[model samples]
Structure formats: structure tokens, C-alpha cells
Target chain A: MSAVLTLDHVKKVIGGKTIINGLSFSVREGEVFGFLGPNGAGKTTTIRMIVGLMDISEGDIVICGKSIKNDFTGAIKEIGAIVENPEMYKFLTGYQNLLQYARMHDGITKEKIREVIELVGLTDRIHDKVKKYSLGMRQRLGLAQCLLHDPKLLILDEPTNGLDPAGIREIRDHLRMLTRERGMSVIVSSHLLSEMELMCDRIAIIQNGELIDVQTINEFTEQATAAFAFETGSLGDAATWLKSDWNALMMEEGFSVEITREQVPVLIKKLTAEGIDLYGVKAVAKTLEDRFLEVTTK
Target chain B: MGKLIINECAKLFRRTGTWVMFAIVIIMILGIGAFLKYGEVNNPPQVNPAWEQELAMQLEADRAALEETGQNNATLRMFYEREIAVKEYQLEKDLAPETGVTLWSLMSEAQAVIGIIGVFTIIIAAGMVASEFSWGTVKLLLIRPIKRSKILLSKYLTVLLFGGLMLTVLYTVSALVGLVLFGMPEQARPYLAFADGEVVERSMFIQLIYNYLLSSIDVLMLATMAFMISAVFRNSSLAIGLSLFLMFMGGTGTMLLASKFDWAKYVLFANTNLTVYFDGVPPVEGMTLAFSIIMLLIYFVVFHLLAFFVFAKRDVAA
Candidate 1:
């Protein structure tokens, strides 16, 4: 897939201090790209630079084949973003807030606004003042605002910050649908590792304002060696031989061993040939959180 | 651009404070109208049959005051000279001052309400850019397809429009109230204006309208100053406080300085009342219309430069 957004050595300097240093990344079209970073690692700073909320001190950012610096209007026209929080005018109704944003862009009809409000499931309370809205409702309103003009890219920073489980799931499903069915690109930055694992196809991990790794979700979690716990009736007389052959360790009910997948069948056949009682074998998978901690700690 | 302006206006007019401001302007005009009408009913203005002799005595006293004005105090000397010239013209033309308050005269007095409008506009202007930051909306606002300068320009233009509306309301409602309370003058008398040592005739209606606009110069400058500070500092309270302080005290302070220092003519407040120059008095000697206009233009350009520069370049971390 072609890159929908590109950041080339993008840097942000404030008061002679570099906040974001030489960050380079590209987000592909029709992919939910996740940005994972520790607090104070400059994730929001990078996002702000992308959306022109912060000036880029060095390098260039291009969106949809247009440079943001030379052609800001052309580049920004393709993006819909919510930075940090969905801060809206509390005095205006949710619908009026959406209408305010809809007017900023071209060719957004009231009917289109209705469609977006429906998509975000804010149809019932869209006309209520935003001050009365709960955080979740404001989030839905923010999403509705983002989708009004049908932008090519959606950039949401901490989109699930205030959402409950159901709301986060609903947003994840929506992001998946938009990317898969409509070929739209999404850039999501969140501290929720498990959610990012479920929601993103790929994630970029940054630390100290530097890009550390960018890999698919599966690649990230699958690279570490797994421990397989074989639940059986004690190993019988074969316990000593099993320790010698497989380097097994004793457990309360079963023996746990670290091995590759291909060796599992061989070991199982040998155990059965020895007439050892075998009940179950399971691989304790390494979760994304485990891998994320492993990667970030390094 | 039009849509942006509409959005700004929508944000402004939707707030309760905005409507409250308009209501205050109207209620003030009516309140003063009622008070003046009460005074007129209770104690009528006495029309003296020897008004001509009274005018001559006043003119003579003005001449004495002019003589007492020291050679160094040119501003005071100019004030008395203009007074003497206008009174002399009234005496020679056999024109008598209207003893009773006329609608035009009441409206002129009611023009003090424009200062209230200036305060209201300053409040609006101070909050225009600063509130977005406080509300955490500037981050979303700046990420649009439009440029930052355009947004700031649209907001400043909205301030101008709001100020103009307030001025228009002050003028119109005051006229309306004055019409109800004080009837039109017995005969339409031209306003006597002393200019260049000659008293000139100007239609009272047109002259009042002209004064209404010219008097707004100070207000426009203060509003602009408030807007600039708000944009540069992103602090509404500071913007409001600083601008309001200047609005109330700047003119008097500048006039006091202008009495002592020739350099005070270059100050903002000294030139703000360009209407004074039209009425044949300069805050400082040798201050001309062309020179004041150029100074105002310089200040206007400088304020805009500082506002737009800081606003366009600052990061929207909020």
C-alpha cells in the first residue's frame, strides 16, 4: 500500500531544546497505525506537528502527495484530527459544534452531518448542549466531527482516553470498518497496549523522542520464546530421563518446558512410547503488554 | 472566509454574555433617558431675557482666562481661544443658546454611553483569542485547512463588527429615547464649530453622527490593543485588565503629560481623540490631522504585526 502520510526527520524545538528528535515514519493507506510511547516521549508533540498545531522546526511532513509547508491548505484538507482531548464549545449543542466544523470545510451538507452523527450513534442527543454531555458522548461527537467531511486520514490522539469498554470496542470496530471497507487511513496514539494490540495492524514504539521499532502486532509478540506447560500425571519413572532429555522443571501438577513448536510432536511421541500419562499441553502465549514492556524497557 | 466569520459570529452571539452586553447598552440609554426626563419635568431650564449680556460677560471672562494662560501652556490657551471665537460668533450672529435640552443636545450628552460600549467591546476583544486556549479548543481550531493568520483576521474583523453594531445601537437607541423625552429643537439650528479661528456652520444631525464615529476612535484603539495583548499573551485577564486601565486612565494621563511635554503628542491616547482636532484643539501644539493619522496607522500596523506574528508562530499545546 502507498503511504498516506510521511514524516521525514520531523523535529520540534522549543526554547533551544529538542522535544521530538529526527522521528521518521510512514503510515500506509487503509491501515490503523498505532503510536505507542511512554509518557513524556513526545507522541502528542509528533501528532501536533502532523496536524499543524505545532510548527515543525526541521524537515518536512507530506500528506496525500502534498507538502504541508508549501501547500498547507491542500495537505490539511485531507486530514481530520482530535488532539489530546475532544475540547468543544460547551455552550453549543453537539450538532451545532459539528456544524461549526462542517462549515470550515467545503461541500459538507447538513445531510452529511446527520449521517456522521448517526454513524457515531449520537443521533439521540446530538441537539443537546455539549456542556450536558458526558465524556463518552463528547467523544462520539468528536468522532462525528472528524467524519463529517469524509477525510482521507483520521488522526486521533488518545481517542479512547475517557471511553468505557463498550465505547472503546465500538470505536475499534468503526476504525476497522473504515480502514477495511473504505480504504481510509487512521493514526491512533494511546497508552492502552492491549487495546492497541487489538485495534492496530502495526505499532511504532518510541522512547525519549526517538523511534525504537515499528513492527506488525504479531511480529512483536511472537518473537520471544514461549514456555509450554505440559499437564500430566507426574512423568512416572521417566522424570529423571525427561529432565535429562528436555530440561524439564517440576511444577505442582505438571512440568513446564521451553521448546519450539516443531519439537512438541517429537517429545509427545517419545513420551507416549514410554507409556507416560499425558493429559494436556498448552503454550503460555506472550501478551502484547509483556512484549511492550520488554521492548520499551530496553 | 465568510464562513469563518460566520462561525466566529456564531460563537460570539450564542453566548449569554454577548446578549447581556447589548441589553446593558440599551438599558443604560433608557435609564439615563428616564433620569434626564425626570430632571426636565421637575426643574425646567430657565431662559433669561438678558441672555445676550450673559454671553458677553462669559466671553469677557474667557478672554481673561486666555490672558492668564502662560505662554508655555499652549493647549490651555488654544482651548480658551476656541471658546472665545465660538462665543463671539454666537454674539455677532445674534444666536442664543437653547435653554431647554433638545433631542440633538440630549443625544450628544448620551454619547457618554459609548464609553460603556468601549468597555464591553474590550471585554469581547480580550476574550476572542484567549478563550480558545483556556477552553482547549485552539488545538482543534488551528488544525483546519485555513491558515492561522486568516483565523486571527476573521476574529479581529468580528471585533470590529461587534464594536460597530454597539456604536450603531448607542446612536440609534439614544436618538429614539431622546425623541420620546426631549422633542426636536424649536427650530433646526446649525451647530457652531470653531475651526482655524473661524466659526463654521454644520448641520446638527450630520455633525452628531460624525462625532459618534470620531469619538469611537479611542474605543477602536483600545479594543485593538486588547486583542493584540490577548493574542500575544494568550491571557484574557491580563488583556482585559491592561486595556481597560488604559481606556479609563490613558487619556487623562496623556493630556496631563501633553500639558508638560511636547513628546506626549506621539502617545496613543493623545491622538485617539482626533475629534478634538476637528473641534479646533490639539492635545499638543503643532499636532496636525495628517500627523495624527500617520501615527495611528503606525500603531495599528505595529499592533497587528505583533498579534499575528506571535499567534501564527506559537504552538497550540493547549
Candidate 2:
């Protein structure tokens, strides 16, 4: 698939300090690309640069094949973003806010406004002043605003920063639906690895202003060594034999060995040939959180 | 660009503070009118029917003094000659001498509302850009499909529009109240001025419009100053505080300096009041309307340059 956004050697230097050092990434069309990083890892900074809120020190960002430096208006017209908090005018109603945003773009009809409001499930409170709305409702209103222009790319920096679990789930599901139905690419940044794993098709991990790795969630989790636990009679004997032969370790109720999926049957046959009556063997899968910690800590 | 300006205006009108400021302006105008009416009702001034006799006496006394002094000073000679011309014209027209309040006089008095308008405009101008940063709404505004220059220009245009709106409200309210209290005059009068060693007469309506425009010069400059501060600092309180303080004290401070130093004529405050060139001499000798206009233009360009350059270049990290 073609990329909706591309960062070519993007660098950010503020006050003589390199905040983002030679970062490069591409978000493909119709995919939820997750940006995983700890606090102060240049996630918000990168998002800001992508949205043209801050200047890119030494590189260019191209949105839908238009360079931001060469054609800012042309490039930015294809993007809808909420950098940091989705701050809006609290004095105006959500509908008025949407109207104000609608004026910035051409050909946004009243029917489109109603459709976005309904899509975000804010049709009931869309007429109320934004100051009176809850944070989740504000986020929904922000989403409605981003959708008003029908942008090709949506960049949300920490979209679920202060949301409850239910709100987070709703945002995640809404983003998934948009990606699936509208075929619009989304770049979302978060520190929550579990949510990223569940929400994103692919994830990019960054640490200390450097891109550590970028891969599919399945590849990130399953590419690690597989651990298999074998529950059998004579657990101590099996543990010793497997430890010498396959470098096994003792588990709670069985002896565990680290091997590939293809070698599991061979290991099981070896254990049985040693006259160890095996009860069952199961492979232990590494969760995204575990892989995230392992990658970040390394 | 048009849509951005409209959006900015819509946001401006949506704020409660903008409406409150408008109400304050209207109430202040009404309050001034009522106070003047009350004063006139409670303490009526005695008008002398034989004011011609009084004028003859004063003119003779001024002539005797000029003779006694030998009319050595040019300024004093000009002053006496202008006073004599005014008194002679009033006696010739058989007009009452400063008798009762007229609609024109009330409208002239209502010009004091310009100062109040200046305060309100300064408040709006100071908060125009800074409040966006404080409210965190700048992010939403800058992420739009338009350029930053268009965004900032649209905001500044909206501020000027609000100032114009307030000025219109002040003039309309004052005119309406004056009409109700002091009926319209049967004839339009001419304003007399001492120019080129003789008395000159000009149309009063033209003079009134000129007065309004001239009086608004200081206000426009100060509002622009406040706007520049708001854009550069992005702190509404600082912009308002500094601009308001300068608006109130700038003229007085420049006057004090003008008395002591000739270089004070070059200062912004000394050149802001373009009205002085019309009716009276500038605070400093040798200062003319063209010079002040040039000075104002320089400051105007400089302030806008700084505002636009800083707003466009500075990173919106917050």
C-alpha cells in the first residue's frame, strides 16, 4: 500500500539540544500505525512537526506526496490532527466550534456536520457549550472536528491521555471503524503498550529520540523465543534431563524449555523416550507488554 | 482569507466578555448624558441678555492692556486678536454667549467616550491573540488548511473590526441621546479658527468628523500597540497591563518631557494626538501634522512588522 505520510530524516533541535535525532517513518494508507514511546521520547514533538506546529530542523515531511516545506497549505490540507490536548474554544458550543472549523475548509455542508456529530455520538450535547462538556465528550467533539474536512490522514498525539477505560475503548473502536470503513490512515501515539497492541495493526517503538524498531504487532510479540511448559510424571528427572539436553528450567507444575514451534514435537518425543510420562505441553506466548518492556529496556 | 476572518469574528462575538464590554460602553455613554442633564437641571446658569455690553467692556479692556504692553509678544498679540474676532462675531450674529447646552456641544462633550472606547478596544486587542494561547485553542487554529500569516492577519482584522464597532456604538448612542435631550439646531454653524494671522471659518460638520477621526488616532495606535504585545508575548494580562498603563500615562509623560527637552517631540506619545495640530499647537514647537503622520506611520509599520514576524517565526510548543 502507498504511504499517506512520510518523514525523511526528520530532526528537531531546540535550544542547542537535539530533541529528535534523524527519525524516519512512513504511515501507510488505511492502517492504524501506533507510535510507542515513553514520556519525553519525542512523540509529541514528532507529532507537532508532522502537523506543522513546529519547524522541522533538518528534514521534510511529505503528506499525500506534497512537501510541507514547499507547499504548506497543499500538504496540510490533506491532514487533520490534534497535537497534545484537543483544546478548543470553550465559550462556543460544540456545534459552533464545528461550524468555525467547517469554515476553514470548503464544501462542508450542514448535513456533513450532523453526520460527524452523529458519528462521534455527540449529537445530543453538540449544541451545549464546550465548557460544560466532559473531557470524553470534548475528545469526541475534537474527533468530529478532525473528520469535518474529510482529511486523508489523522494524527492524534496521545488521543486517550486523560480518558477512562471505557472512553479509551470507545476511541479505539471508533478509530478502528474509521480505518476499516473510510480507508483513512491514522497515526496515534501512546505510552500504553497494551492498548497499542490491541488497536494498532503495526507499531513503532522509539526510545531516547531514536527509532528502535518498527514491526507488526504479531511479529513483535511472536518473533521472540517460544517457551514451552511440559507437565509430566517425574518432574525433577525430566527437568534435569531437559536442562542438560534442551536447557530447560523448572516451572510451577512442569519443566519448561525454550525452543521453536517446530522442535516442540521432537522435544516431546525425547521426553517420552526417556520413560517420562508426559501429561501435556503448552507454548507460552509473550504478550505485547512484555515485548515492549524488553525492547525499551534493552 | 475571508472565511478565516469570518471565523475569527464569530469566535469573538461568542465570548461573553465581548458583549459585556459593549454593554459597558453603552451604559457609560448613557450615564454621561444623564449626569450632564442632571447638572443642567439642578444648577441653571444665568444668561445675560445684555451680553453685547459685556463684550464691549471686555474688548476695550483687552485693547487698553495691549496698548499698555506695546503688543511686544507675538503669541499674546495673536491671542488677543483671536479673542476679539470671536467676541465681535458673536456680537454681530446676536447669538447668546455660551447660554445653554446644544446638541453639537453635547456631542463634543460626548467625545470623552473615545477614551472609554480606547480602553475597551485595548482590552479586546490585548486578548485577541494571547487568549488563544492561554486557552490552548491556538493548536486548533494553526492546524487548519490556511497559512499562519492569514490566520494572524484575520485575527488582527477582527480586532480592528471590533474597535470600529465600538466606536460606531459610542457615536450612535451619543447622537441619539443628544437628540432626545437637546433638539436639533435650525442652522449648521461654522467653527472659527485663527490661522495665517487672521480668523478663518470652516464647516462644523466637517470639523466634527475630523475631530472624531483625529481623536481616534491615539486610540488606534495604542490598540495596535496592545495587539503587537499580545502577539509577541502571548500573555493577555501583560499585554493589557502594559498597553493600558501606556495609554493613560504616555501623553502626560511625553508632555512633561516635551517641556524639558526638544527631542521629546520624536516620541510616540508626543505624536499620537493628531487633533492638537487642528485646533492648537503641538506640545513641542516646530512639530507639524505631516511630521506626526510620518512618525505614526513609522511606528505603525514597526509594530506590525514585529508582531507578524514573531508570530510567524516562533514555535508554538505549548
Candidate 3:
């Protein structure tokens, strides 16, 4: 499947300072792509450019194979976005806010307004004024608005920000359901790496306005280097023997020993043959957070 | 387009400020009407009868004085002619001319309240759209499916509609108030006169409508200025305040400037007031109704254009 969203050599500068420089990434159709970055990492800036809320200083942003700068409204027609904060009219009812957005897209019926409100689970409170709504309710309403137009691509910035655990779970499940049921592509950016690991099909890590890496969770885990851990009755003897003999043996056998858990079994068997005791063995698997920190830190 | 206009009108009506302005116009008209009538009832204009009688006696004495000095019959005829002219002048002076209707005369009963209603309706008309931005409704407005220019156009029309509604209420209440307070006068002539010699006499109701239309232009100017400022600053109070301040300055700024400078007449505000069109002659020698109108129109167009350009081109991301 072709990419639904693509940024090629995108650069944005404000007041003589570069906000995003030569950033590039693509999200495939039917993919829940999580864009992970720290605060002030230019995530919002990139999202704004994608949504046509700001003019791009350089490079092209293609939404569904259409350039946003050249074909803004046309490209935007197929993309839905909730940027930084869910800005809305405080005085209007939740339903009214959705209705206003509904009018922007052709063929959106009043019935569709009811449907989206129901989808967001805000039907009962849609008539309440937005100003009176809690932050979670507002976020849900904002999601409802983005979903109203039924765009093929959904771009959300920090969708789980300021939400209770249940609210965050609801959004996470809702987004997964949306992608699963409709086969829609979603780009969700957040600082919460664990949620992204759970929710996204693929993820891109960005740091300092640069794309550090893009990989699936499984590939990221599988590509991580295996570490061996070891335990022995005599810690000093084990270290001394390994430093001289095992280190050479493992290196010569096309393996690297880190004096971790995997070496415990080998050392025990070898030590028993040499009349020495072994106690324990262990192996370590890398976590998403560890991988994220590793990639972004560099 | 029609739906947008209707929606704007609906929003306009929903505003508490709109109701407040309407109430102010009505109360002002009624209050001014009652004050005029009460003053009229308690203090009828006192005519100077003594002066009138003295003038008449002087004319009669002049006739007698001229005849006594006549030398020939023809001379006596000339003397008598001069005496008759003197007597006619004195007789004319002795009889008091009928007094023109006062504010009380027009509104004490109900009809005069129309003029006062017209004034406040115009004031309210100026504030309608500017208040929306002041209240931060423009964000909700611009994000809708409609174009930006169309939004402003709808507001422009709504301001006029509001002016019409307020003016209607003003006219009805003033007429009702007039009928109740004072019986309808026999000569129901309109109070307005154009530059043409022809007098445009309207029924009290029609006069109210015409006067409202005349006052609406002031609101239109203010609304346009407010729209420009609202679009530029994107703040309602600033737009309303600046526009109103300019209007206030327009009324008296010229006079103050004239004391210090000879070019006061060139100021835009000094030329914006439509009252001068009704007042006999304008304060400035070259100032005319047509000139003032054209200048106001130019300002209106310029402000709207600036607003449109700024709104369309400004980076909204900030």
C-alpha cells in the first residue's frame, strides 16, 4: 500500500531559529503510526504544517499523494487533525461545535453528527455547553469533530494529554478500533512511549527536529543485541577465569560474553568439569522505553 | 448566503448587548419626550406683549407726526403713505407669530419620540458586529464552512437589520406615547426638509422610518470602522472603543482643531457626522452632504479592504 502521509526534507524556521530541519517520514495506509518525541522536539510544528495551519518554509508535505501547500483544501479534505490543544468555542454546545465542523465537509448529515457524538460516547452530554465540559470531555469532543468529516488520515497531537487512566484507555481503544474497522491510517504523537508501543503498528522516533528511527515494535525488539548474565559461588574467581579464558573462547567462537546470565550455565558446566561451582543464569530483553531512550538520546 | 445572513441576525439578536441597546433607545426617547412635555406644561412660552403694544403705538404716532408737517395735498398724500407703512409694521409686530413645536410637543404625546429613538438605534447599529469580536465569537465564526468575507458581509447586513428593528420599536412607541400623552395635532407635517424647495411631509410613522434610515448611516459608518478594527486587532472592545472615540472626536474634534489649526476640516472624523446634513449650514465652508457621504464611503471601503487583506493573509497559527 502507498503511503498516506509523507514529509520530505521539511524545514520550518521561525525568527531566525530552526524549529524543524530536514525532517522526513511516511505513514502507510491502515497503519497506526506513533510519532514519539520529547517536548519542544518540533512535533506540534510538524503537525501544524501537515494540517495547513502554518505555512511551510521549505519542502513538501504530501497527504494521500497530494501536496498540502499546492492543494491545501483538497489535501486537507482527506485528513483530520487535532493539534496541540483542542481549541473550541466555549459558549457553543458540544453538538454545535461538531455541527460547525460538519458543515465544512460536504455530505455530512445531521445524522452523522449524532453518529460521531455517539462514537465518542458523548451523546448524552453533546448538548451541554463546551465551557462546562471537563478536559477529557473536551478531548473526546475534539476527537468527535475530527471524526465527523470521516477523513482517510487522522493526525492527533498528544491525544491522551490531560486524561484520566480510563479516558486515555478509551481514546487508545477508540483509535485502534477506528483503524481496525475503517482501515484508516492514524498518526498519533505523544510523549507516552508505552501507550504508543501498545497502540501503534509502526513508530517513528524524533529528536531535536530530526527523524532518529522508524521501526515496528517487533523489529525494534528483535534487532536489539542480546546480553548474557552469569552468577557463580566465587565471584572473584569467575571474573578472573572469564577475563583470561572464557573471553577468548567466546570471542574465538564468534560470540561476545558480557559476564551476564547466559555465561552462568556455560561457566557452571565448565567449572564443574574443572571442579568449580555455578549458581545461576539469566538473559535480558530490551523494552520499548529503553530502545526509545537509546535512539532519542543519541 | 441567505442562511449565513439569517444566522448572523440570529446571533445578533441573541446578544444581551443588543437588547440593552434597544432598551436604552426606547428609554431615552420616552424620557426625553416626558421631559419636553413636562417643561412645556409647566412653563408655556411667555410672549412679550408690552413690547408688541409699544411698537404698535409708535407706528400710530409716526402717522400723526408725518401728517402734521405736510405742506401740500400731494405732500400730505406721501406723508399718509409713509404713516400707513409705519402702522402696518407696528401692527405686524404686535401680533405674536405661532410658536414652532418643541421636543415636548412632538414626543409628550408620542410622535416626537421617533426622532430620539432614531438617534439611539443608530448608536446601537454601530456596535453590533464589533461586540462579537470583543466577546471572542469570531474564532467560532471563521472556522465554519463559510468564507471570511461572506461572514463580514452577513454581519454588515445584520447591523442594518438590527437598526431597522430598533427604529421600528422606536417609531411605534413614540407614536403610541404621543397619542396617549397628547392628542394628534391637526397639521401632521414632517419635521425634515431637503435642499430642494419641495417639502416632504410624512405621517408620523413614515417620518420615523425616514429618520431611522437617516440615522442608520451613522451606524453603518461605525459598524464598518468596527469591522476594520475587529479584523485588524481581532478584539471587540478595542474596535468599539476606537470607533466610538473617533465618532465622538468627529463631532467636536473639528472645533477644537480650528482654534489651533486652519486645516481641521480635512480630518476624516470631522467630516463623518450626518447631523450637519440636517443642520442648516455646515461648520466648514466647503463641507457638503455629498462630500461628507463620499468621504465616509471611502473610509468604509478602505477599512473593509484592510480588514479583509489582513485576515486573509495573517498567519493564524499564532
Candidate 4:
């Protein structure tokens, strides 16, 4: 996949404090790249810089092969974004707001507006003034406006912030469909790691303005060591036996094990006869949240 | 550019503030026109009768001089023709004072007061542009496929078009009101004068039209100033406040310096009343209408340049 957006050693400082220091990342075409970071980790700042809403103190951001500083119009031409809260003209109807945004782009038709409103599931209430809209509805409208330009890259800063479960699900589904249908790439930032895990193909985890890791979910899970746990008819015996066995294994091959529960057996006899005794055999799968905690903690 | 302008114009029409301001201008013009018409009815001045008497006396004196000379019939006819010419001149002069209170007169007064209305235009213009930022829709605005400069220009043009429309409505309606209230006289006359004693002859309708047009420049300048302030401040209220303060200070600053400082002639408000230049003898020396126009043009350029620079560079993250 071609790189739709690339930031190289980008740095930003405001009022003598560094917000993003030498941060680097690339978002590829047709990839749903999740930018996972805790609040105030400069995720919003970086996104703003990419979308040409903020100036970079140093370094470069390239969008669709155009430098943000040198070719802002060119870089922004195919980029759409919702930085932090989605802001709109409350006095204007949702459709009017969308129309205002659409006018900024060349060649957007009325059908396209209808298409976007439909995509965001706001068509029924599109003519209502935005002041009457719920936060989720406003968010959906913001998404519709961004989509109106048919941009190649979308930088959504905490796009799911403040959304209800249903609204979040709807947005996630819509985003997935958009990517699949239009081959549009998205860079989404959120404090919710689990949501990112479910929605994105790949995720970049950042802490303290530094990108700690970028990995596919499978890679993250696979690399995380699974806990080999078992239970025996005798809890004490299970603990001792497993400790000795796992300790030896650890010494020899670096494999690990732990006792989790005890169960009667047919199990001990069957496991001893087949050389596997502990009835409880469980290996913990590494969830995205687990990996996020480990990475951020580290 | 054309598309942006069209969109801006459409938005202006859609906005309720534009209509509200239009209604205010109409009310002001009609209210003032009505009051003046009522005043005219109650207190019809005495000069009109005095002017008629003066014309009659001039004609009678000419006839008496011819009789005293015992002139022949041909010479008496010559005297009669001369008397007719003097009578025509006197009648034209007599029409002058009445012309000063006609519909054109009210419109000219309205036009002069239109500078004060620039305050309203400034608020409207500032709000029109600054509300986008206060509402935080600038993000949506910039992301669209158009250049930032064009978007800013669209807003500026929209405010200007709205101001122009309001002025047109105010001027036209006020004239109609004046004509209805005070009988529409048959002949139009020039109401203003030149210091060199040269009279500018214009139809009342044309004078009213020019007054509206000329006042529009002040509106345009104020609108541009308000837009620039809105661009920088990004808040409609603050933009409105600061713009008004500056406009007020512009006049005050000019007044304070007009007597004390020779260079005060370069200040924008000091030179705003272009008619003052035609007053023949200027209150201050070395000031000309051409100079005022040039000064105002410089200010116009400066205001727009600041607006464009600040708007294009400032982050719209707010």
C-alpha cells in the first residue's frame, strides 16, 4: 500500500513546551490505522498538523505526496479531518452546513451530499437545524461533511469521543464500509484502545508524545506470552508439581506455567497416563487492552 | 472566485441578520423621512413667498425703467424680453431653498448620516465572518476543495454585497417615502454647493442615487475593517466591539488632530466626508478630495491586506 500520509521526525512546541517531539509515523492507503494514546499525548496536535490546521514547529508532514508547509492547498485538497469536537454552525440546518462545506470543494454534486447524508444515516433529520441535534447527530454530521469531499485520507481525532454504544457501533460500521467501498484510508485517534482494536487493521501506540509501538493485532497477541495454567485433583500437589515442572522447563527452555484451578479427575490419571496430569489446562489470550497496558507501562 | 461569491451571496440571503439589518435601515429611513415631512407640513418656511415677491419686483422694475425711458415699441419689447430673462433666473434661484428640503434633501441627509450607519454595517460584517470561527465551522470550511484565500474573499464579498443591498433599499425607500409625504415637485434641483460658487446641477433623483453610492464607500471600508478584525479576533462580539471602538476612535482621532496636527488630513475619517472637499473653502488648508480618496484607498488596501494575511495564516482549530 502506498503511503497516504507520512510524518518525519515532526516536532511541535507551543509556549516553550514540546507537544510532539520528533514523532514519526506513516498512514498507508486503504489502511485503517489506529492512533492509540492516552489523553494529552499530542495525538490531537499531531492530527491537526497533518490536516494543516496547525503549524509544525519543525520537521515535515506529507499528505498524498504533498508537503503540508510547501503545498498546503495541495496537501489538504484530498484530506478531511475532525479535530477533537466536531464544530458546526448551529443556526444552519445540517444539510445547509454540509452544503457550505461541499461548496469549498470543486465538483461535489447534490447527489453526493445526499449520498454522504445517507452514509452517516442523517438523511431523515438532515434538514433540521443543527442546534437541535444531539451530540452523536452532530458527530455524524461532521463525518458526513468530511466524506462530502471524497477525500483519500481522513484524520479523525478521537472520532468516537462522547458517543453512545449504539452511535459508536454505527460509526465503526460506517467507517469500515467506507474504507472497503471507496478504498479510502483513515487515521483515527482515540483513548479507547479496545475500540481501536476492534475497528483498525493496525494500531500505533504512543505514550508521552513518543510512539512506543506499531503492530497488527495478530502480531501483538502472538508476541505476548500466553499463561499455561492447569488444575489437579489436589491443589497443593498441582501447585508443587506444576511449579517443579514449569521451573525445570523455565530453566531449560524458558517456557512458563501456573496453577489456576483444581478439578477432580479422571483427569489426573488420564493426564499422568498420557503424561499430562493437571485437569485445568488454560492459556490466556492476550487482549488488545493487555497489550496496550504492557506497552504503555513499559 | 465566481462560485465562492455566489455561495457567499446565497448564504447572506439565507441569514436572518441580513434581513434584520435591512429592516432596521428601512425603519430608520422612513421614520426620519416621516418626521421631516410632518415638520414641513406644520412649519412651512417664509422664504418661498419672499422668493416669489423678489421675482415679481425684479420684473416690475424692468417694466418701470422701460416706461421712464419712454422707449419705442421695439425697445419696450427688448426690455420685456430682458425682464422675462431676469424673471426666469429669479424663479430658478427661488427654487433652490425648497430643493434643500425635497426628497433628495432628505436622502442627502440620510447619506451623510449613513456614515453613522457604518457602525451597523461593521457589526453585520464582523458577525457574518467571525461567526464561522466562533461556531467552529472553519474546519469544515477549510477542508473543502477550495483555497483558503478564496474562502476568506467570499466572506468579505458577502458582507459587502449585503451592505450594498441594505443601502440601496434604504435610499430607494426613503426617497419614495419623502416624495409621498412631501409632494413630488416637477423640477429636480441640485442641493449642495461648491466653495468657488460653482453650482452642481443634478436631478433630485440622480443626487439621491449618487449620495447612496458615495456613502457605500464608507460602508465598504468599515465592512472591510470589521472583517479584518473578525479574522484576527475570531470572536464576533470582540470583533464587533474592537471594530466599533476603532471606528469611533478613527473619528475622534481625526477630530482631535484636525485642529492641532497638520498631518491629520491623512487620517481616514478626517477625509471621509468627500463632500467637505467640495465645500470650496476647506476648514483646513492643503487638503483636497483627490487626496482624501487616495488616503482612503491606502487604508482600504491596508485593511484587506491585514485580513488576508491573518486569515490565511492563523490556525482554524478553534
Best DockQ goes to which candidate?
A: 1
Q: What global local distance difference test value does model 3 have? A: 0.68
On lDDT, who's better, 1 or 2? 1
Candidate 2 per-residue C-alpha lDDT over A62-163 given as tens digits, one digit per residue, 9 for 90 to 100: 999998878888998899888878898988999999999999888999999999999999988888999999998888888898999889999888888788
Per-residue accuracy of model 3 over A1-298 as CA lDDT, tens digit each? 8898999999998888988899988988888998988888888888878877667889999988789878766788788777766766666678866765665567888888888889999988989988899999999998887888788899888999999999999998998889889978999999888888788989887878888888897887666655554444544354567678766223322233545455556656776776544454446566778777777776
Name the docking class for model 1. high
TM-score for chain B of each model, two decimals? 0.91, 0.88, 0.68, 0.78
Candidate 1 per-residue C-alpha lDDT over A17-78 given as tens digits, one digit per residue, 9 for 90 to 100: 98989999999999999999999999999998888878899999999999888888899999
Deviation in angstroms for A105 in model 2?
Answer: 1.2
* Candidate 1 runs further than 4 Å off: A229-258, A262-282, B63-81
* Candidate 1 lDDT by residue in tens digits, B183-231: 7767889998876778899999888989999999989999999999999
Candidate 2 per-residue lDDT, tens place, B13-52, comes to 8888889988987888778788878887998867887888
In candidate 1 the C-alpha lDDT for residue A84 amounts to 85
User: Considering every candidate listed, which one attains the maximal TM-score?
Assistant: 1
Model 4 segments more than 4 A misplaced: A226-286, B44-47, B52-96, B99-101, B112-116, B190-197, B280-283
lDDT of each: 0.90, 0.86, 0.68, 0.74
Q: Could you estimate the TM-score for every candidate?
A: 0.92, 0.90, 0.75, 0.82
- In model 3, state the lDDT of residue A41: 86
TM (chain A), candidate 3: 0.84
For each candidate, give the interface RMSD after superposing the true interface residues on Cα. 0.8, 0.9, 3.9, 2.0
Q: For all the predictions, what are the DockQ values?
A: 0.83, 0.79, 0.23, 0.44
Docking class of 4: acceptable
**Of 1 and 2, which scores higher on DockQ?**
1
